[model samples]
Target: MTDFDTGIGDLAERLVTATRTGDHDYVADVLAKLAADDPRTRASALLRDLVDTGAGMIRARTREDNDALYTFDVTTEHDEPVHVDIVPPAPRAALRALAASLNRDAVDRDIHAVLATRGTPDEVVTVLVQCLLWTLELRDTRTPAVRLNCF
Candidate 1:
């Protein structure tokens, strides 16, 4: 796999380990890494959109259902009140669904779903989403006590 492809796997593994150890900082660290101006921004933006429209599609287990609302402060010095929302799925759902997409009967269908929502026909993104889903799945393990509905 390419570095970018491999990076997703690495990120997944890190998220897994982080969850196992109850390290809340790992998500922040992953999100904060400035890989590309657009990619990172898009990642955060997609996260916001997910929480807002597709909440429970990739969310933290620690948060309550009402806490699914996420506000991304994208305000810049040149901008004002630039805010965004992120509705994430429970980590478990994201994991199962994402993994399922890889080998499940709904491969093309799942991919189309993402494309409709994420506007990407790129396989790279498909793989990346899998990684992201796996990462969050591991993250959910950190808080086994906080259970919620899984997709």
Candidate 2:
């Protein structure tokens, strides 16, 4: 049997309430609650989305020889395979597009789309963490590690 068959329904409902509040801490807290009540898978997925969606700060920003660069990575307890290309400081329009894409894609698919998209490493990491928290609260999953790579 799956945790989804047990108290997941009530937990999911509460998660909706938390999200509607638009309070990051609330969302994260409720997510943690859900994890405690449910399975570890939910926690994993939640953490992945949080890190991928910037639902929390997951990206890294630094100046290298006066040149700014971004680094990002994705990991899954499900062990989902990813080969992501490094994205630099893209144009404002590009970043906006990425954000729009992430929001739309994350609505149902969670942070999968955001994890797949290329953006500033810092932004990517942050989104993943935020979305992961939301995902766990709204659903249930495992928490994966943050993988970083530079090119």
* Each model's lDDT: 0.38, 0.39
Candidate 2 off by > 4 Å: 1-6, 33-39, 44-84, 87-151
Q: Name the runs in model 1 displaced over 4 angstroms.
A: 1-6, 32-96, 99-151
Reference-based TM-score, model 2: 0.25
By TM-score, the best candidate is 1
Q: What are the TM-scores, per candidate, against the unseen true structure?
A: 0.32, 0.25
Going through the candidates in order, what is the number of backbone clashes in each? 13, 37
For residue 2, give model 2's deviation from the true position in Å.
18
Q: What is the per-residue lDDT of model 2 for residues 1-151, given as tens digits with 9 covering 90 to 100?
A: 5334555444444544566566668656554444453233554343333334332222222122323223333333455654433333222223332344333434433333423333444443344344434444423322333333222
Q: After aligning candidate 1 to the native by TM-score, how far in Å is the CA of 21 from where it should be?
A: 0.6
Give a tens-digit lDDT track for model 1, residues 1-151. 5323454435445544565577757544444442233434434333322322222333433344542333223343554543322223323233333333323325543443343233232332433344445345544555534222222
